[model samples]
Target: MDIDRRTLLGATAMPFVPSVLSAAVSADDWGSIAREYDVTREIIQLEHGNWGMMPRPVLQAYRAMIERVNRDTSYYARRGMAGDLEGVRAQVADAMGVAIEEIVLTRNATEAMKALILQYNRLQSGDAVLYADLDYDSMQASMQALATTRGVRVMKMALPEPATRQNLLDAYRMAFDADPGIRMVLLTHVSHRTGLVLPVAEIATMARQRGIDAIVDAAHSVGQLDFRLPELRADFIGMNLHKWIGAPLGVGALYIRKDRIDAIDPDPAEDPARTDIDARVHTGTPDYAAQLTVPAALAFQAAIGGSRREARLKQLRDRWVRPLRDMPQVQILTPDDPAMYGAITSFRLRGRTSHDENVELARTLLERHGIFTVHRDGLASGSCVRVTPALATQESELDRLVEAIRELAS
Candidate 1:
């Protein structure tokens, strides 16, 4: 006799069972995992792309570390903190399939990417650097500063709104072929504006063949996607642990390939002779508690695995987006292609693409329907409201968002 899948899972849920997760799990099973997150009950949160709320286990670990640091203070600072930091770094490096020598911790993606951008030593006075409009604003500012101080040219492009694989590749190809003076390109692994996942390895290879380097801004992609350093085929990258990794806030990292570490200038705050990746970052008086809790966050993510989490987040995004795609006056920014996106998506009404209009729409969603989203600017096409769902978000919560958009769009 054959039994149902849920029944089979229930039968195996015995004492001392570990949290083994599978992407094919039933809705009830997904909800069971969702319960482990301590999200707010007052609002239907659909803006988790900014920062992820830590799961209960990670939060517990964070609180415990805080207490321990408070108890010992200077002693831990002088002695125990070094060993704990090394252990966390080893776990993070192991998880990403990278060497510990190549990674360094920072406050967040802004700090990490800024360090990578401002410290790159390849540009000449007239050489050009390329970046897209959808790149993070802070990183863009750092690139602009390079142009002013170092006298390098800055070129910007806009991604196609309804982007396709071939078109996306073609755009970058044309850009590189058109300009030999462009020596460095900044790429976003997954766009924060519309959740469009660029083909990083392909673009990076294109840049390399032309003697150009690529710096990846992976703020929203690391824990949300399954690929790692070697897979991206880039020499430098900046990542966020607080966003999708569900670690405590104020944690991020940067990666410089072992062979290419010397190409970037060291942080002046540190000894100039130090060429290690850590020398690129100089976060004074670090958040020792959060740094110590990084291992627990890594452990929690390891239990569920990156592939499973990626599948689950994509599933949730599709569920809400599929029903609303055909609705008139609503334009979905993220394409339906699974390979092109993860959890984050954005939408705009037929003519509501202006900054004020999009902001008002987001306000209406929150005030009228109790669904929360954020208005994002800097899309070359126009502004839109970004909707992001966390791993802990429920189907019902997304359904409410769908219904509210239906009502608003009508």
Candidate 2:
């Protein structure tokens, strides 16, 4: 009698578990060792780096919070609920290695980035603010809106893919070099389109050297990458916990280096030093329970082990690269360099028009095949599907994605 593969593999797995992990790794075994959270790959969910699906505990906590709030709305508010919210922010601040005094809880990275960008000392008529064309559209739109209303200049740089990190570093240098008058620089922690992980420390160093304020839109970096807030040294940094952190959708964090806090003007109102982290993020009263659940998400990250989580995501990524890296028409936009990519990777359909074709492709895959992905329509590149995986993604599941793309491309 031969033992089944699943049974044999399960007997040899480790007992350690992360509350918020999507998958577990054990020795050479490829299956998710942890109890299944039931996120099937039947349709192929390779875009987790875009929006991290919550683990069971997080989903349960979220649903319970909503139910409790609805049961006794008044009792929950104007009570000890506010303290719980603060605790969540403090834990997040500590995890990111930033002081709570300099942190602000927000709905997403875009909100935090916009709040900081709006606070530039002053944007003179001829003074310009620089950002990459790859920056998220929302952040880019905020700059454009300011440009139109404030008579400021907007300088955009279009970065190429399959390029070296120095190529990116040089692009920023070129953009700023062309116009020494560029007062502020907006950058992405990970290009949502190219999946390029930039040398943020180097970029921040250049900004300080040039006397420019660097505000980074880190919608994709936080949980997917090991980020220490204190070391980044950017004037302003915003992160979305929901993307790779596996938190509820409403939660995100902004870390302002304590010394740099004074440099930023806190939106329409000035928040006293004692105010909660929401000083700039408070858009009227929000769902306190929604905010309170963020720490649980962080706990999940801690349990999985940060570096190990990164390694697992990388393992899943390799499954795709092995098959598609050699494809001729498939332009792997993501840097093959491990230092430059995490859970997210992008590719352009060479000899193809991706814009409308990709938009339709997105809907068709999701509706017909149940595969969900980003259309990449927002970027200058017309359209292509981006695949990203969380720790929970299995090799067999990832193979499904490579097979589909190869078939489509072939």
Candidate 3:
């Protein structure tokens, strides 16, 4: 029997049965898996980095939870919701390989990261914090804000354009050596601008040796990459469930090592005396339905298996990227190294680095080819258009994207 969206959604409750596939599933098997997602037919969607779409089963579960929450209303919120949310939190913690006491739920990664950045208590006057161009824009702003709030100096550097795992590590090591006053550093596990995966664990370990705390922004890495949260070796980390986890929008998580909880100040509204992980971010009244549907999303992801999912995503990425790697007119920002990239990759036309040029390039792909992509700025080298393939994206659609790039480059 062929598995399809209807078949999955027909289940009375969300199914937790794992559908473990071999390292590389066959095309027909992938096609059957793709059928589990009901994507729009209007445009070829290669822009899933913003957020992930819930598979049909997860969506059905989300709708059911929404209705249930709406019907039960305050009675449920005031009575059993707390306990239910704790169960959800436990599931998330277990998946992240952390204790429940070390993780807390938040609206999104930005909220969790903002709380970590703003509430971090170790900085003093003249202390310096380091971040690179690849960091998220909002996070960069928050790091810069420390200059005013904490009387710390904010230092920004640009990662090497053609980055390598060793050079990337050396860059941070050298930066730390140059500036001993650096008290904290912000690390983006995967670059949103160019889809470059940093050597986060190595750099975090380097920072720790120098007595500098590292705060990792893992918004794009958690579910997309097959790694445990502890692997990054950071004391604090923030991640999004909505992006790669395929959870409903408005779900994210914050992780703080139990021993380092005191490093982060409690939320202003939270009582200082009660400074547990939960007190770190006080996001009052989140989307309860979305939070409740997390288990369904996890079950859906688990069924696919993390290693298999990562392989599939990277396979999709390489389909287009490998073909264009040597094209004279195209500049692929990410290197060929497997460790430095994942599903997301960005490319630039040799001479088109301006913001408007890249924007127009993305526009041409959408308007002319019926393909959707996004233009990202903030890389020191220049602007580029990012192509991100979701689990549901067809190989034929990526082939179309490759053809479009070839024609455009010509």
Q: Which candidate number has the best lDDT? A: 3
lDDT per residue (tens digit) for residues 61-89 in model 2? 56666766676687766775666666676
**With candidate 1 superimposed using the best TM-score fit, by how many Å does residue 378's alpha carbon deviate from the native?**
0.4
Please report, as a residue range, the 10-residue window in candidate 1 with the lowest summed lDDT: 8-17
What residue pairs are clashing in model 1? Answer: none
TM-score of every model versus the real structure: 0.94, 0.87, 0.95
Q: Residue-wise lDDT of candidate 1 within 1-410, one digit each (tens)?
A: 12232321221111111243333143337886787787887999999988989877677667767877787898867976776688778777887889999888888988889988999998899999999988999888988898986799999999877898788999999998888999999999999988999999999999999999999999999999888778999999999999999889999998999999988889989888987888998999778788777776776677777788899899999989999999987999988888999999999998777999999999999999999999999999999999999878999999999999999998
Sorted on TM-score, highest at the top, how do the candidates line up?
Answer: 3, 1, 2
Give the per-residue lDDT of model 3 (tens digit) for 6-99: 4333332344543432222433378767777898989999999999988776787788788778988998889888887888898999889999
Each prediction's whole-model lDDT (CA): 0.85, 0.71, 0.89
Best by TM-score: 3
In TM-score terms, candidate 2 sits at 0.87
Q: Evaluate candidate 1 by giving its C-alpha RMSD to the native, one decimal.
A: 6.2
Residue runs of model 2 more than 4 Å from their true location after superposition: 1-30, 33-36, 40-42, 269-277, 360-370
Question: Model 2, residue 232: displacement in angstroms?
Answer: 2.0
